[model samples]
Target: MNAPAHDNGRLALMLNELRLPTIGRLWPEFAERSDKEGWQASRLLGALFEHELAERAKRRIERHRNESHLDPSKTLATLEFGLLPMVSKAHVMALASGESWLEKGATILMFGPPGTGKSHLGSAIGHALIDVGYRVLFTRTSELVQKLQAARKSLQLPSALAKLDRFDLIILDDLSYARKDQAETSVLFELIAERYERKSLLITANQPFSGWNDVFPDPGMTVAAIDRLVHHSTIFELNVESYRRRKASDKQSARQRQLPEKNQEGGTTIMS
Candidate 1:
């Protein structure tokens, strides 16, 4: 038989918020059904409610963990078709082997021409590292160099690099995109030297090693930097067609023949 529905005044608000049906609907049904059930039906219902609450707590914890992960939102799914098989196949296996250089400390160099998906691949790897619970710092090569110079002026260079060391993986995207002076080049090389073997470095560049001398400005420093970078690194050369060109062509073809109307509702406000 079921126990009497007590005056649950203390939890009445909570029960109502949980959408638990009131006695008006449930009490009569329980009373009518209790005669047939040998066990206490109310106890069974309470047990079910407790079990559901526990399950919900577990789910909430899992959701929080997933959301807390530094998901860069870069995934293998968004990778362009041309670069997929090569990067995802044996390459992933090679890097993931032994102590996980990707997880531990190693370097990955992705060299290719502009619009060949270099940044996308580097970012995807960073996201993959984050999934493995490694802290990753990502920035464009140009921006990193600029920030380092700014730090030197503020006398915070050491502190800045110290913070960089905390990251398990560092991704420098678009290396050599903007023209860098000799001092900036030296600072960048020093960063690589300092981080050598201490943390994993992921570099994406539009130019190959052969063309890197243009970035370093000094031929001797260029050779030294390239030597240090390639010594213990996995290199991928992407020689694919420009995805940007394809996108541009599609956009051009979709242009309307007639002039589109422009809306200038407010002064100096332009809308197309």
Candidate 2:
């Protein structure tokens, strides 16, 4: 027998009040299906609960992705893994799972020349981790350092750092650009120190450790920062041709191939 109209209205009201929007919208169709198939009450309840949980997980992932500020285009699926021969796809996939290392607050340091896909790989990792229910934040190291510096001047540096702690991982892209002066590097160091062994960091830098003296003002500060990051860390040195340069060269070659050729009489002839 069909539920009375008043009973259905009351159930809808109760579902809305209880904030079960997904179930509320879906229950009528499920109820019809259950009636048609003669499903037991337990099965109907289990189905509803499963759908509710699934929808909740989906919404949570979407919310986290928006807040992550990751480039939507950069993901593991879109990355040209073949070009980065030094980076093992198997290893990256394992890290992307984010089960073991992220929980331990391990760091991921990517060292490479510009346009070599360091930033792309870092962003891809962030996207992958987010899919597994970890919150992430992606920002240029220089931009984040400036914000921290401003927070420091306003006496809200701790608050800023605390806010960042909510993210399971923070990806600092282009770290070499943040080596402006003492104030900026100090704030950056504080961020590194604050998250040490507590939250994960994924940093991409154009310069290797030997060239980091240019990044940190003092040698002692440099050592401390490196020690904190390198401890329990996974390092990826991307020694590959610049992706941008290769792409441009490929485009140029294709255009040259498409250009019309001159015939023996100097007249342009289209090549088939």
Candidate 3:
């Protein structure tokens, strides 16, 4: 009778059959190193498994990051914390880790003016969460509401909401930009209701809750939306000088200083 195939060959075949390409490809080199170094069988196997697990984790994180649609430039590393004192660095870091209040399907409301870093901060948080394996999707509130309205018109709102559930966190930027139409607000309400107590939301709004009435014309709807969102939420009020506005002013001042002075009669005059 022909001798049975060797155990090493059988093991390689089985690993490939299971589709564990990483482990299968590396095992031959791992075994060679073990023999050359006189390593214990247990130690050699442990190293192999560790390498496989690490590679799998890296690929998983990469997949999540690509699907997240986050701003590659926005992250805590790039944040100008000194420019905004109202927001605590420690608190922002805690939330970015996605292991604190996010556990309870909580909401985060970032309130600030247009020139402030509201959208930047929101996208940064999403990037951080995705790095640690959280699924995040970021979009403008107006754009998202339009999509929901389209789904409703097509009678596929439920399917659309179900697809959105794939994200562990949703970052909705510029909430105040959503039009104050009844049809639009209704879909927005539906999204909030679906995610309530189920998934986390981070919203950046140029207006405060009191002014939210301008987005949802119905007073009852405004009250209901605010009540649900703020009940289990953390609000970040960035009451700092507008970063964009300050930069623009600085540029204007530099230009003015570079220009030659003109007398009231409109002739260029050299300064003494």
Candidate 4:
């Protein structure tokens, strides 16, 4: 072989032996292009890999959360323009500042009517707490009651309550959405009793203390639950008008209105 041809062949073999990805090596132009655009090739690749890994991790986390029957996605961070009491925010920040949920049991009760953003605030706090590496569990009141009932039927009520005790903060959203019987009350009280001083709880309700008698089905149990929950709980009564009502505009209502049409027998029918 000619000397020049031999040198070229050796150089090609060495490039192949380098074992860089074909795109990263033979297509070095793309790498330079990415760099000329003020982007780091390695960083871009790293970012892509990181994003892909994070996406996989997120999917796995979502699956585990689903299987655990606790929805972390319901937290307040996901709400649009969420608002919480100024003092409540300070208290919440103080709780999170402790760097641990086990430091002290801080319970929050967000009570208001429907569409009042109670769930949003509760869920956001849960998310924030979880972000700080605290074990936070979020579930609707109805769902929690149902699970408690099932656990009782299986003779695992204590275990269920104990598991709840493990959470740094347990967020019960939408309380009083449905009525609860005495049996449910007993089960719920067991949970509260177990976590009395061990963990924190965040509750969002559509009803106030006065209306809770309808939920517990007995004045005694209602008082018991309220006492345990409110003993060290931070009660935030969100008395603002329903968010849905505030968002509705008169022009929107006018546009949504329907014109009246003359029907048979000369009677006008409003077509809504």
Candidate 5:
């Protein structure tokens, strides 16, 4: 039998007050199914709760993903692993699982030339970690540095860093773009120092260790930053040819093959 309108309204009110939105919306349908199938009270109640929990988990992930600033298109499935032969698929899968390393506040450093898929891999890893319930923030190293510099100028640097601490992992893309000035590098170093051994960092850079002096400006600071990052880190050196360059070459070849040919009479003729 269907619940009376008054009873249904009262139950919805109570559910809303209790903040059980999924259960509130679903219970009516489930109640009908229960009656039709002669499901016991316990079984119906369990089914409702299972759905509520599942929906809550999904919503939580969506909220976290929105806050993460990750590109929805950049996921492990979309990553072109064939172009990145130097990177081990198994190793990336292991990192995606985020097993023991994330808890230990490990780091992932990706060093590669421009267009070599470093940023794509880093963002893919970020998406994977978020799927497994880790909060992640993906931002350009230059942008984050500017924000930190602004916070420092306002004397709220600590508060700013604390806000970032809530994220399980922070992916700093294009770290080489951060200007090599004391003001900018100092705050950047402060962030690295604050998160050391407490939270994870995933950095994508076009520069290697020796070239980081152009990023840090100070020899001592460069060493310190590299030390902390490399301490418990997994490094991926993407030494492959540029993906963009390869794609451009392929497009050129295709266009050349599609071009009209010169016939015996010296007139252009379309390819058959």
Candidate 6:
């Protein structure tokens, strides 16, 4: 039964005021059932709160996911972990499930050749973290360096870093793309130093530590950045073959194999 007009209107108003629209809109039906069953006040109140909290959580997850700036297609369901023998599914699932390591500012460093799905893995984990309420930002190494460099020119580098501090984890894709120049490397170094042990980082790179000199201007700076990043981090070396190449090869082979299977039995076989 519908609630009385006055009760419906006033209850809706109260729900709006208290920011519990989910429970407010449906409470009238619940109220009718409660009246029928003689549910106590505490039970009714608890039901309302449970709906409200569930809605709040849903909204929170959406908000975080939108703000994460990650590839929407990259998610746990999209990643074919079986093809990547080097990747440990257990470890990645653990990291994705729990926020302790990310919240405490531990870094995840992923290294691999191009097309090896390093970026995919990084973005997927980032989205998973967002699902669990961790604020994450995905950016390329070059783009972030350019942003930081521009901020430095305007003397707002500190302000920029302050803004970045809001995210729980920063996914820096293509860490190997940073140009080997003082101006570029300096800003990159500053960014690393600022987040050192203060915020979590997820970095994808094509180069190993010994080859990092190509990105940094000097050996000392490279060492410094490496030291801070590796101090509390999980290094994932993705040595498997490129996923793109493998996928393309599979498609080609499928087409090639289908050509001989249908000729004699099929209704039509075109000949020029």
| Regions more than 4 Å wrong, model 1 | 1-73, 82-88, 93-99, 245-272
lDDT tens digits by residue: candidate 2, 56-133: 999999999999999999999988887888889999999999978988899999998899999889999999999999
Q: Which 10 successive residues of model 6 have the least lDDT summed?
A: 263-272
Tell how far residue 167 is off in model 5, in angstroms: 0.5
Candidate 1 TM-score over all chains jointly = 0.62
Clashes of 4: 5
Cα lDDT over the full model 3: 0.85
Model 1 C-alpha RMSD to native: 10.4
lDDT, candidate 4, equals 0.65
Between 4 and 5, whose TM-score is larger?
5
lDDT of each: 0.67, 0.90, 0.85, 0.65, 0.90, 0.86
Query: TM-scores, in order shown?
Result: 0.62, 0.89, 0.83, 0.60, 0.89, 0.88
Worst 10 residues of 4 by lDDT: 19-28
Arranged by lDDT with the best first, the candidates are: 2, 5, 6, 3, 1, 4
How well does model 5 score by local distance difference test?
Answer: 0.90
Q: Compared with the true structure, what per-residue lDDT tens digits does model 6 show for residues 10-42?
A: 878888998888897778888889999999989
Clash list (residue pairs), candidate 3: none
Clash totals for all candidate models: 0, 0, 0, 5, 0, 0
Worst 10 residues of 2 by lDDT: 257-266
How would you encode candidate 5's per-residue C-alpha lDDT over 31-53 as one tens digit per residue?
99999999998999999999989
lDDT of 4 by residue, 1-272 (tens): 65443454565577467643342333445545666887765866665456555655566555444543444554544544434333355565555444544566757888888876677666666655555446677787777888898999999988888777667778787777747653465666677777876788888888788988777757898888888888776777877766555545534666555333224336755454
Worst 10 residues of 3 by lDDT: 259-268
What TM-score would candidate 5 get against the native? 0.89
Task: List candidate 2 segments past 4 Å from native.
Answer: 1-6, 248-272
